[model samples]
Target: MILVSYFARYREQLNLGGEKLPLDASLNTVDDIRQRLIARGGVWADIFSESNLMCAVNQDLCRLDQAVEDFDEIAFFPPVTGG
Candidate 1:
C-alpha cells in the first residue's frame, strides 16, 4: 500500500487530507501514481489539473517523475505559501 496525502488548499478543495491505495497493481514512479489518480476522475483529476503540483515521498520533497516504492508516504500539494 502507498499513502497519498494532500496539503493546504488542495486538501480542502478535495475534502481530503490523505488516503492509502493498494499496491497490488504495481507502480513504478510518482508520476505513474499521479497520472493514475488524476485519471480516476472527479476531485483528483480536477486537483491535478496539470503536472504542476508539488510532491513529497517519505517526507522528502521530490519531482513529479521520481521513483516510488511500496508503503511510501507520498504527499501532493500546490506550491506552499508563507507570511
Candidate 2:
C-alpha cells in the first residue's frame, strides 16, 4: 500500500487528510498516480489538474516523473506563498 496525503488547501478542498492506496504496477511514478486520481473525475480530477500543484514522496519534494514504490508516502499541496 502507498500512503497518500493532501495538505493545506488541498486537504480542505478534498475534505481529506490522507488515505492508504493499494500499490500496483500501473502506479509506477508520481505522475502515474496523479493520472489515476484524475481519472476519478469531478473533484478528484479538479484538484489534481492544477498546473502549479506541488508534490512530495516520502517527505522529499520531487517531480511528477519521480519513481514511486509500494509503501511510499506521497503528499500533494498547492504552491505556497510568503507575505
Which one is best on TM-score?
Answer: 2
lDDT of 1 by residue, 1-83 (tens): 99999898888988888999877555788888888888989987888866569999999999977888788999988887789
lDDT of 2 by residue, 1-83 (tens): 99999999989988999999999889999999899989989999999999999999999999999999989999999999999
Q: lDDT for model 1, on a 0 to 1 scale? A: 0.85
Prediction-by-prediction clash tally:
0, 0
Residue pairs with clashing backbones, model 2:
none
lDDT by candidate, in order shown: 0.85, 0.94
Model 1 residue runs over 4 Å out of place are: none
Model 2, 46: alpha-carbon shift in Å? 0.9
